[model samples]
Target: MRTGGGTGAGAALVYGTGLAQGLALVCFPAASSILTAPTGYDLSPSRYGLMFAPQVVLAITAAALTPVLARRWTLQRVLVAGLVANLLAMVLLVLSQAPAPSGGAYLLLLAATGALGFGFGSCVSALNTFAAALVPGREDRSVLTLNVLLGLGTALAPMLIAVLLPRWWLLPVGVCVGLVLAIAVAWRVRLDPGPAAGPTAGTPKAVLPGRFWWYAAAVVLYGITETLFGNWSSLYLSGQRGLGVATASAALAAFWACVTVGRVIVAVLPARIPATAVYLLLPVLIVGANVAVSGASTAATAVLAYAAAGLACSAMLPLSISFAGREFPRLGATSAGELIAGYQIGYGVAAFGVAPLMAATGLALSGVYLVGAAVAAVLAAVAAVITRSGRRPDPSVPATPPVTTATRSDVPERP
Candidate 1:
């Protein structure tokens, strides 16, 4: 925070955690893709899909559990646990090799999901908590930067792994290196201590006022847009644009690259703008980008559109997380996890349904983008309304006590 507004302690921890997340996501996604390659493991299309579905479910559930884990265990400890889980998963996957036995693949998949869940859940939770404590009033733009940097890390992993693995056996070998790097980075930092709400820090008893759910839903809706592209932009580019698969992948990479850039920009934006205003802008940006993505006939147009989408979607989560955490401090980490889980669920559902719908109706990828745009628009309106109208209720007392010298006595003293 010497240069930025956040404290150095919080910044270091978040940045390191971001690195770890990047490494984990990068390694997991890239390493697993080779599973179904006939020349490699020869898994069936359906089987490959099944193998990965568990990963998503487990990861999403684990992410949602972050708040509970954080309350029970400090953020750093949880992350350490996650790292250990990641190491174990990698070992099992490496050892379970050769012809893919149904038992072995699923075992490895479960282990991997556990590992990912641990790493993702703990780090995301800890970092958000740490950030809230450190950055007092400076949440919005700063979080955007974190999101961008993290996206860059995620996006860069596949390309790097692709380059490393072309020589055959070196692919899985690189995964070990990544896992170690992720662990090392996570080890170097510490989470800023969470709020001193004492017993209610992160509990079912943790109060979630109406305002909290409002922000959570906003994040959920916005998140669907982000995850949709992340999961399928390459396929859309390849199939719809008639670009070679490699070329389409490059487009997807560009999307991530722009996401990072957009996050950086938003992070530096002026504080004069209200959160409501920023939230409202998200839908507008998303619609424009999605339209570009679907309607573009040329590769250049595709890249530009998807990249804009990445950039536009970048700040949506950061803004929502910041708003939710501060607006409902008691539910800070829990809401963060909830919103993230919502996003993942939306992603999973959309991924399964959208592609098939397009295939069946002969609707172009444009149709998919159009639908996503509509969703984004609805989310924007809701966020604006919530930001403008909803007020966080006092969780400490069922009713606001009559103001008097004695009423002040019940207010919890700040740590």
Candidate 2:
């Protein structure tokens, strides 16, 4: 398990990549004003929602491709490629802000977001896998820490946007410059190219294990709840709840800040504190918070409710991936990628599918919070089932042993 001198550098690189991912992700929701402004794209809510569809679709594709790509490339190489994509995405986004021909702006924006999705998906898959591999037995804590950095980036985006937009292009431009610096940092960091030590190492890869599907389903629900609130809360606060633009931005920032803070709390908790307890308890809190958001009459009430919802939902995604990695250590990256794909599917459904439903049914923005609550309730039941089923190890699978000397060649090939 010794990683030599590169462990510290690798860890820093992973966290830095996470910070960049968070900053990039927040741009979409944070830039909602410019994206839908009459002077800008003048996009309808449905159209704005549609813009996310490409990102989701491309992200799912990138995630699915990560494991396949990793077989031929070093994990660091894969990460670098993703970062390059992110830089391209940022540049494209900046360009989309320029005056363009009729309908060209929308097309350019979609292309930019699609690139962003590809970059985020690939980078996240690689970083999560790299972090898990760096600390063999502490996958949960490592993943949580990485995601905490990402949440910090997400939190910063809104505050930056509130101050910078009408000139939102600066956000992406800043991200692009950051990516350039991050890519350089990543190149200098050396990652341990070792096979993950686990009981299932030599076993034949099973075809989509039952437990993985359960985890995937749980993340789907998690994605729906998380993205629905993150993307829509600003609009809800401003348009429906009568908050000013800056106030709505502040609310969004508060929500992401809570998410970052909540993850930090979980990361430091005793390792013996079962993740199942968190999985189960968080959904109940999320359901309550969503209900609160639904009934919120003032900006203050809505901000508190959304922040609470962020706190409740913060650990669900990372924890689900951590659980899967622990259960199937040998397939750590592949399993994580699958779970991410499942998450993106849910995100797409919630982000894009919900908008038209709202348009048709005359559901207020808060009504979507109720829908998220229902999904979260289902996620809770799934978590309970996971808890019960995970009580004992499968007899068919053995516990993974600690890895001895392993090279890049020792890494398992794609199943």
Candidate 3:
């Protein structure tokens, strides 16, 4: 598979993936209203939750399978397939909006979400690899920039829903059409493919370093904390906090907006500021934000707290991935794909595990943000341990030599 490509094409591809992810992420919250409007299917909460299960499961499956698939398909092909899957998902969603047989609508919605998950998982793995390769030594900026596009997509979803719902049930269909056009544009852009998977002395196929697992653990926690807010915050605001539907949606938008804004801030910071310092500070801020969100007596306070949480949580995943890439320089793409899989695992847990707890606890769900905050604390501790230990390498594990373009033809050209 070809790996190098023009920087312009690579950026376009990455940004497209981000927008696809954003649109897919909003499906859950948007569905809450989309499935209940006068012309809609009126799905129950259990049924709505069931629709998400397949998306998360299938997405995890797709992400786990990417490394294997990359062995045969070009990275560009894999990305194109992902975009095609997203297109199919959007078509399914549009069909779901049309009048359908009694139970078929729910099934259509399920298929749409599942396809979306597959698309998202595939694109996420591919794009992160591409981003890491794009800037070479400055992976933090590339990853952050990529995620900022993603955050923009996520932030736009709720705002679109707020503006177009009820009267414009078909607005998402139009959005999907735009996405399909964007995908077509991306398809025409030639780019580098993923690196081949092979065992090398510098990058062993057998044993991974211990610190890799530490990074994975942090990613898992980051997923839990981020998903807790992204997935549940709307329900918490409307159902528990007694905010109006539009207001709650706005708050959700606020959370993602702050996330996007925070990424921009992190991206521009002086490289002299250690990433570890940023990592250490975020968890404390996240914990405090969660505390404020849980105790918030008014909608305004809760919205502000959720936004604060977004800012606090923004840099964790991208920076963690960047750190892992630096630590395992020889296996940058592989390490990224693996850590992302770890992230999806955590996402699956949060989606499946937390919802039931919320249902069982009812009003007590308001306190669930604390659990996320606590997880963030664990993540902070893990980062600290990794930082202290990373100064000295273990004798048992051999240090891998850094990868070079001559060594791997598939590594993309630096922008």
Candidate 4:
């Protein structure tokens, strides 16, 4: 399974982008306090929530177009393009700091989020493809590793924002520098992301098989579940639970830290434990974690609950992308993009969707979390269906020989 120097370099660059993307992606949400503070951006709950509306729209569009763009432009070029967009997002965030919290500042924030959405969509899709193709037989572990780094970035976001409090713009500025370096390296290094390259790039296949909808449905649900925590946990803790801003930020950091830790645990789990089992089990945990968070009153209790939710959410996205790649060999790297689009759809539903419900019904976030538990239940049902059948390995990637040892991943074929 040795890779050439170029492939290894490409893989490093791709994985690094995952971390950078994670940081940039969470910057806005992680600074939720500042955005909504009366003296800060002066954004209301609805306006703050609505900021991501454009992000969801553009992210889905960019993700959906990844395959088409890869076909026409090549995966390396697409990755670089995504990085450029990511840089623009950071730049916009920095510029938004220049204006006072007026319509002008708010509009800039909206634009920044929209750019972030597009960058996230394109960058994550391409990174997933490269991660799988670069590692061949180890696609599952590779994807998990990539996402572990992503989770690490997410974990760092809240803490970093807290540390650099009045200097929030510095975070995005730092991200811009990292992205610039990644783009430079990626632009020069040639990456052959298996079938997405010239060989089958021109091949016209069904845009997506009907079966993809199963993975899509699972991830969309997952998106809703994760966003409930990722986007709103800080606000929920600070506003509803009556915690200090710094304490709430710590709780958010704890949640994402546990996410990274959980992903690491999943990656190293004994091979006998089936991935599908882990996948199915996570949503069920998410269901329970939601209930725990909803009921938590004290800082310690809320932090612990958030940590549990993070662990529950840790591996769903990576597993979804990995399973989709295994199931649709012909689609190659593009399969990740389609799955990402589905996830963004869920993100949209939860991101902008919950705000209106609260504004219209005067419901509290605690109640919203209760509704999330129900969503996670449905997600578990979808996971059951997705994992019911064994994976069909990708033909392009060389399959590892079946291991003889009893491993953590082993499970009965039927539930």
User: Which candidate ranks first by lDDT, i.e. highest?
Assistant: 4
Angstrom error of the Cα, residue 137, model 2: value is: 3.0
lDDT of 1 by residue, 12-53 (tens): 656655654665565655654566676556676666555556
What's the true lDDT of residue 105 in model 4? 89
The superposed Cα distance between candidate 4 and the true structure at residue 166, in angstroms, equals 2.6
Predictions in order: lDDT: 0.63, 0.76, 0.71, 0.81
* TM-score versus the correct structure, for each prediction: 0.83, 0.88, 0.87, 0.90
> In model 2, which residue pairs have backbone atoms overlapping below 3 Å?
198-400, 199-399, 199-400
Better of 3 and 4 by TM-score: 4
Show how many residue pairs clash in every candidate, following the order shown: 0, 3, 3, 11
lDDT of candidate 2 over 1-415, digit per residue (tens): 2333137777877888899899998787677777777876688877787787788998999887776666656556678898998998888778876654347878888888898899988999888777666665556677789999999999988778877856767888888888998888777666653365221333444356676688889988988888877777767888888877766766677788999999998888765576667777998988998898888777778788878988998888888887666656566567777788889988888877776889898998888789878888998899887767764333335753433211111111211
The window of 10 residues in a row where model 1 has the poorest summed lDDT is 405-414
Candidate number with greatest TM-score: 4
Instruction: Report the Cα lDDT for residue 42, model 2.
Output: 85
Off by over 4 Å in 4: 1-6, 195-201, 359-363, 392-415
Q: Write the per-residue lDDT of candidate 3 for residues 338-367, one digit (tens) a residue.
A: 777788888877877886777787636567
Q: TM-score rank, highest first?
A: 4, 2, 3, 1
- Model 1 misplaced regions, further than 4 Å: 1-10, 31-33, 89-107, 167-190, 196-204, 359-362, 390-415
Question: In model 2, which runs have C-alpha deviations exceeding 4 angstroms?
Answer: 1-6, 100-102, 165-167, 197-206, 359-362, 391-415
